[model samples]
Target chain A: MSLAERMLKIDRRIIFLVIGLCTLLPLLYPVGLPIRISSEVRGVYDHMESLPERSVFLLSIDFDPASKPELHPQAIALLRHAFRKDLRVIAMTLWVSGTGMAEQLVTQVAKEMGKEYGKDYAFLGWSPGGQAVIINMGQDLYSAFPSDYGGKPTKDLPVLDGVRNLKDVAYMVSLGAGRPGVEEWYVFGKDKYKFELGGGCTGVMAPGLYPLLRSGQINGLIGGLRGAAEYESLIGQKGKAVAGMDAQSATHLAIIVLVIICNVFYLSLQRAARTQRQIG
Target chain B: MDATILGAWVATGLTLLIFSFLYKDNPLFKLAEHLYVGVSVGYTIVKAYDTVIVHLVIKPIIENGEFALLIPVAIGMLMLTRYVPKAAWMSRYAFAFIVGMGAGLAIPRTISSFILKQIEDTVRPVLSLAGPDGVTFSMNRLSIAGLGKGWHEPASSFS
Candidate 1:
């Protein structure tokens, strides 16, 4: 068979295997490549930096497990930043599946940083009425999220003493995946209530948010695994996002190389076929 | 020690077993995929009931005696009308309530987020250097400078 024919007929399983190996190998041993920090990420970091100590910030984990490989790292990186800065954080999840995972992550990171829950941070678990809850927060904070993730009244939490509405919030970062994510926050919270807003989103949804970032609707954006890596870099704490970047880079480059090789093989075969036809 | 390591080994084995289907279709992947779906759906239902019924409905009535919740309770029941084709129009109240609330929730945010914010960020200049007085500033300032502290002259003017 001609080289082009052979290339065209290569098994899809081989391609899958190649892609898997390309992604897996770098994850096992990372290259520590220097990452360019986008302003979208720096915006959130800068916003947090600019906040006074103990500023009330809402860190919303509006994502689920399917997005864990992307959004989980963002949650961790942001939580780590908030804790490091001694910012009073209120963690919550709009996604049901994310509640347990987000809680586990926050607890682990908080412990690592010696953070106390009710005193330093509080996690107000999932709420069903999404945007209604956000709007209700504008009118009455306790009515919106009456209880913390553990079922303690948010009204009585020492950390939330004076925090009554979005106006009381210094800045809000919504680490999100889909509907009721950054968009919901900007509209419900930042629009009418007028709170500073930012977000971190999965790769697939990142492009849609660029216009928002450009407009300053959101102060910053941490996009996909790359955003998480950049945020991790800023905090000077390497974690899963950084590891995943190596994998991402390797996989992207592998796909490019495969495309190039296939094209070259195709062109060579075409030239050979033309020569044979001319002679015949 | 052996048991813990063995458990890890078993986990690794199951992972590989499930992943092997990427090379080709297999019963193991099917079983795992079905179990995952089942568990996920169960979790979602329980969560929904806890939040929607228990918290929003049951708790409200029990704690506050806010019988006004029946409006939402009726709307919630209307959602079941979807299963009966003849009575599907009865579901419109539920749809309208949900969609209306969604729109009420979405429209204002859309205006603030997309409309107002777009104008603010776009019409704003990128050359205000009052924010950073350093000799050099990041290129972000060069592109969309909005009221910064440091640079007096526009970078465009310098070039």
Candidate 2:
């Protein structure tokens, strides 16, 4: 076979290995890539920064463990920023599978800030109905969730003192994966309740939400791991998202190079075939 | 060792088992795949029972003397009739109620949020529009500074 044909027929496993090495090597040995903060991510940070002390900030965690890596860091960075600003934060999940992770994550961040549970924040855990739950909360917070995740009465909690319903919330953000997530939150929660809302979604869903953001229905969007990294940078605290940027950069470059090489070899193989047929 | 640390080790091992499939499909990969799905489903069921059955229904009836809640509970239970071949027709009532309530709640919002507003944004002039981020920029003055943005630089550094 001609060299061009041989290159064209290279083993699929070799390509996998090339991409794998591209990701794994940079992760193990850190080569910190300078990450530019996009305005979409900065919009989230700036809004949180503008909130006054004790202002109500509700976060809806609308993703399961399947989306943990991408959405979790975004949650952490946002939570840290909220607590740092002394915002009274209330977190809940519309996705049942996300309840345990959301509980643990909010608790961990709250503890790091040395913020008291009832006073500084409340974890409302997961409720069954997706849209109905938001509508119920819009009317009466106590009716939707009588108690926090730990089963403490929410009405009595200092963190939710003035928060009778979704309308009471000053600013809210939904860090979500799919359906019954950012879209549901907007349609059922923000559209009706009139609360200022923001969104952080898996990279795939981010593009879909840009329209809502443009309409000012949502204040901002944090998209996928890259968005998470940008928020971390804004907070001046680099976490797992920042750590993964090197790997992300390397992987993207390797894929681009592989694409170029494949095209060049493909063209050469076609040329060789035409020349051989003509000579014969 | 701490329970948290033990959990971390278990998670790491399972992750590695999942990644092993990239080399070749094996029994180990299959095991991890099934385990992940099984665990997630099992957890979902247990949580559903707690949130829906216990908190929403049982606790309200017992604590607040809200026996009226049983009406909706009965509607929900009618879905189980699908298991009986003869009584399967009864399940439609449950489906009807759910579909009706859902539509009543969703249609208006869908129109306002998706269709009408989307048209507004679509027709809105480019210069007049502000990005969702509130950072307004026009195509005319779009500057492409920091051209490379280190995308090509990182991989080269490792090499």
Candidate 3:
């Protein structure tokens, strides 16, 4: 077969193996590339920074295990920022599977920063009725989340003293995997309630939300692990996000190189075929 | 001695067994899948009842007395009417009301959040060299911000 034809017929398994190695190498080794922090990431950091000490902010973990790698770091970094600034955080989840994970992370990060539960932070846990729950929260937080994630009444929590509805919230941020995420919050929670809104989403959903970010529907967005890394940089903390960046950068470059090589080989095959046909 | 710990171990074993299907399909995957669906349905039903009793029925009545409960009670009955073919059309009104209220509640918020707020942020100028005393100026313009503009006039000062 001609070189072009051969290129077209290249086995896909080879590509997969190449891509897998590209992704794995940086993960195993260590190289720190200079990361340019996008305006979107800076916006989120700035928003959190601008909050007064002890101000209440709502952080929703609306994802599950499948999205942990991309989103967990975001949750950790944001919580660190909030706690470091002495901001009061109220963490919760709308997804059932996310409840335990969110709860665990919230407690862990809060403990690391010496934040007292019910004093510096509170968790409302998970509830059913996706958008309905948001609307209920807008109208009255107590009505929707009558109790803490652990089943204690929210009204009694020192962290939530005087918080009634979304009005009292300084900002609402959700680390989302899919539906019932930033979109739902923008529609039901932030609209009538009038709180500043932001999100951290997996890469696939990031580009589509840019229009919203451009227009300010979301004040800022942290997209994928790159975003998590940028956030870590801003906080001066080099954790998993920084560690993951090497893998991401290496994998992307490897994919690009492979594409170029495949194309060159393909053209060579085509040229050889044409020369043979002319001679014959 | 404890049922919870025993249940946890059982769950752990089942999870490992189910994940083993990633290597190849087997009876274990099927069993796990069925158990997952069954447990999920049961949980959903119980949760539904809890929501209904608390949000739709008991709490409203407790807060606002019997009169407050009637409207939602009627809606609940309207939902039930879906089973009767003759009364199916009436259920549309209930659905319509629910959908309409949701949309009505959403549109204004959407306008403010997704529209107005975003415009306000993006339209700001990228450079302003003003200092605290208004005499000292700083020039740290980013090329990324000035991509399309020439570096001369204030209006054209980005690129």
Candidate 4:
């Protein structure tokens, strides 16, 4: 068979093998490639840095296990930044399916940072109603979440001292994967309540939030695993997101090489066909 | 082995099973897919019952002497009427009340947030060369130039 024909007929299994090797090798070994931090990501870091100690920082975990790889790192990096800065954190999830994961993540991070629950931080767990929950929180934080994730009354929690409602929050960030997420926070939680807002979303959902960012409704945005890596670097802590970047870069390079090879063979075959036709 | 370690092993096995679909769809892939959906739905139901019934309803009514919550409790119970066949028509009352109240609560906030606030932000001056104090042309120029440079770097790199 002609070279071009053979190229077109190349087994997809071979391509899959190359992708697997490209991803697996970088992850198993270590190659720390320098990542360029985007301004959107820097915006979140800068805003967090500017908050004074003990300022209220609300973190909404709006993703589930399906998006855990991308959104989990964002949550961890943000938690680290908040704890490191001595900001009071209130973590909650809008998704019921994500509640267990969110609670576990917050607890894990709090333990890592030696943070005291109901004193330095609180987790509100899951509540029924999506937008209604945000609206309720805006009206009266205590009413929205009467009890902490652990079944203690939130009103009595020292962590929530002097914080009455959404308006009292110094800044809020939503790490979201789908609907009833960042958009809901803006519409129900921030715009009406008038608190500063930021967002982190899976890459596919990132572009939709740019208009809000541009309008200052969302002060910053972190998009996908790259965004998580950028935040991790900013905080001077290299975690899973940073480790995954090398694999991503390697796989991207492999795909580019495949495209180049395919194009080269196609062009050569076209030229040979033309020559044969001319001679005939 | 520790329960945590066993759980980790199970998770890893399931992850690999799911990933095997890259070769081609097979029993392992189907099994993992079914397991994920089943676990997720089961977890969601348990959590909802805990959060909605125990925390929001029964606990408040019993522990806090919040008797007023019975109104919502009654309304919520009305939703189950649909399963009763002959009494299924009664469910409309609950649906109507819910939809009506939801719209009532959402409309004004939606208008302000998605429409008016957006307009207010968009109507601002594009280039403010002059501040309240005076025209600081050099500062404005430097600011604009910096923005331009920052915008170009990422676009050029991507291309």
Candidate 5:
């Protein structure tokens, strides 16, 4: 068989192996590449920085384990920022599948921050209705969540003092994977209640939310692991997102190289075919 | 020996097993897939029951004396009628009420939030020259034209 033909017939396993190596090597070794911060990510960082101490920051963890790689770091970074600023955080989840993960994450971060539960933070966990929960919270927080994830009455939580409804929140962000997420928050929580809002979503959902961000319905957005890495940098805490960037960059470069090689071989094969035809 | 460590090891094994599908699907991959789905569904049910039944329903009604909640409770109970062969038809009343109430609540909110507010934002002036002082460029003027011919030169040259 000709070289072009043989190349075309290359086993799919070889491609997978190359990709695996490309991802694994950089992760094992270290190439510290600088991550450029986009304005969207910076917008979130700046707003969080500008918040006064004790400002009510509502964080909606609206994703499950499937999105853990991307959204988890975003949550951690945001928690770091909020706690660093001494912001009173109210965390909740719309997805039932995500409730445990959100609860664990909030607890872990709060412990790291040495922040007390009732004073510094409260987790309202998952509720039954998606948008209904949000709407109910807007009207009255205590009615929607009588008791938080830990079974403490939200009304009595010192952290929730003066925070009666969604409108009482100074700022909010939803790290969402799907529906009952950022869109639901905007529609049911922020738009009518008139709270400042931001968003963090998996990369797949990021482009779709840009219009909302541009329209100022969402004040800022953190998109995917890259956004998480940027936020981590902004907070001066290098975590899983930062560690994974090397692998991501390497895999991206490998794919780019493979595409270039494939195109080159394709052009050469086409040229050879044309020359043979002319000779015939 | 610790439970957390054991859990971590299991998680690592499952992750590797799932990743094995990259080579080709096998029994290991299938095992991991089924385990993941089973665990997720089981966890979701448990969480939903905790949040919906224990916290939202029983706690409020019993502790807080929220008797008005029985309206929703009764409607929810009507949905359980679907499991009965003869009473299955009765579930339609519950469904109808839910649909009607959902529509009543969502329609106006959806219109205002998704449509009207978006239109309001979109219809605003794209470029406004009006500033606090006068009609100066209200936006940042960091144009490529402002960067002269030597803009591409290294900073070392300027130094």
Candidate 6:
């Protein structure tokens, strides 16, 4: 077979194996490539920075496990930053499947930071109503969440003292994967309540959220794994997001190289076919 | 083994099974895919029952005497009529309630959230007519010029 034909017919599994190796190797032995902090992400960090100590920061965990890789790190990074700032955090999830993961993450991070529950933080857990939940919380916080995840009355939680509704939250950031997430919070929570809102999402959803970011609906945006890496860099605490970036970069590079090689092979084959036809 | 370790092993095994599809179609990949769908559906059903039936309906009506909640509960029960062909017409009440409520909440907000707000941002003068000092240009809130202090700008083609 001609070189072009041979290359074209090469087993796809080989390419898959190469891509897999590229990802695996980087994850095992990281390059620690310098990650540039995007302004959208910095928007969240800076807003968190600008908040006064003990200011109430609401983090709506609006993603499920399907998006865990991209957004879980974001949840962790944001929680870490919030705890570092001594910001009082109240977490809830619009996604039912995400409740357990979000609760565990917050608890784990809070424990690492030596933060007390119901005093330093509170997790309200998941509820059924999507946007209705947001509007309900805005109207009557306790009515929406009669009891927190641990089944404690929200009315009596020291963390929620003097917090009447969404209006009282100093800042709110929804780290979301899909619907009933960042956009719902903006339309139903922030737009009506008028609280300062920020957003974080998987990279795929980041571009869609830029308009919201630019329009000031969300004060900042943290997008995808790279955005998670940026937040980790901003906090000066390297974690899973930082580690994952190396794998992402290596995989992206491998794909790019493959694309170039494939194009060259295709063109060469076309040219060779034309020349052969002319001679014949 | 404890749930955590057990979960880890199951997850790892499933992950490998799914990855096996990278080579070619096989029973291992099919098993993992089916398990994923089953688990997802099961989890969603349990969650719904926990939140809707136990917490919202049962706890309120039985425990707190919030009987007014039954109105919505009745509507929800009507939705179950969907499975009974003859009684399916009763489901209209549920659909109507949902449509009416969803539209009420969504229409004006959709216009403002997706349409009007987008138009405003798109057309808003990024470079304001020159003021006394100079042209008051607005950088993206994430931009270095706009972000101001703490953390340098992230270098990305998009940014």
lDDT score for candidate 4 against the true structure: 0.88
- Residue range A1-280, candidate 4, lDDT tens digits: 9868898789898899999999999999969999899999999999999999999999999999999999999999999999999999999999999999999999999999999998999999988899999989998998989998889999899989999999999999999999889999998888668899999999899999887888778889999999999999999999999999999889999999999999999889899999999999
lDDT of candidate 6 over A1-280, digit per residue (tens): 9887888888999999999999899899989999998888898999899999999999999998899999999999999999999999999999988888889999999999999999999999988789999999999988889889887888889999889999999999998899998999988887777899999999999988888888777889999999999999999998999999999999999999989988999999999889999999
User: lDDT by residue for model 2 over B33-122, one digit each (tens)?
Assistant: 999999999999999998889988999999998999999999988999999999999999999999999998898788767865565555
Instruction: Give TM-score, chain B, model 1.
Output: 0.66
> How would you class the docking of model 4?
acceptable
Look at candidate 5 and tell me the lDDT of residue A146: 81
| Candidate number achieving the greatest lDDT relative to the actual structure | 4
Whole-model lDDT for model 2 versus the true structure? 0.87
**What's the candidate order when arranged by decreasing TM-score?**
6, 2, 5, 4, 1, 3
- Which tens-of-lDDT digit does each residue in B53-122 have in candidate 4? 9999899889889999999888888999999999998889999999998887677667666665565455
Summed over model 3, clashes come to 7
List the candidate 6 regions with Cα displacement exceeding 4 Å. B1-3, B126-159
| Model 1 residue B26 lDDT score | 89
**Between candidates 3 and 5, the TM-score winner:** 5
Clashes of 5: 0
Query: Where does model 1 exceed 4 Å of error?
Result: A273-280, B1-18, B84-88, B123-159
Off by over 4 Å in 3: A1-7, A129-132, A269-280, B1-87, B115-159
Candidate 3 lDDT over residue span A3-54, tens digit each: 5676678777666667767777878887888889999999999999999998
The CAPRI quality class of candidate 2 comes to acceptable
Q: Which ten residues in a row have the lowest lDDT in candidate 6 chain A?
A: A186-195
List the TM-score for candidate 6's chain B. 0.73
Candidate 1's displacement at residue A99, Å, is 1.5
Cα-based TM-score, every candidate: 0.86, 0.90, 0.75, 0.87, 0.89, 0.91
**Most accurate candidate by DockQ:** 1
* Model 3 chain A worst lDDT window (10 residues): A1-10
Ordered from best to worst DockQ, the candidate numbers read 1, 4, 6, 5, 2, 3
Clashing pairs in model 2, backbone N/Cα/C closer than 3 A: A213-B132
Question: Mind giving the per-residue lDDT tens digits that candidate 3 earns over B31-112?
Answer: 9878877876676566556655765468657876767667867886898888999998889888998899878766666655
lDDT of 1 by residue, B15-43 (tens): 77778888788888887777768878898
Candidate 1, lDDT over the whole model: 0.83
Question: Which pairs clash in the backbone of model 5?
Answer: none
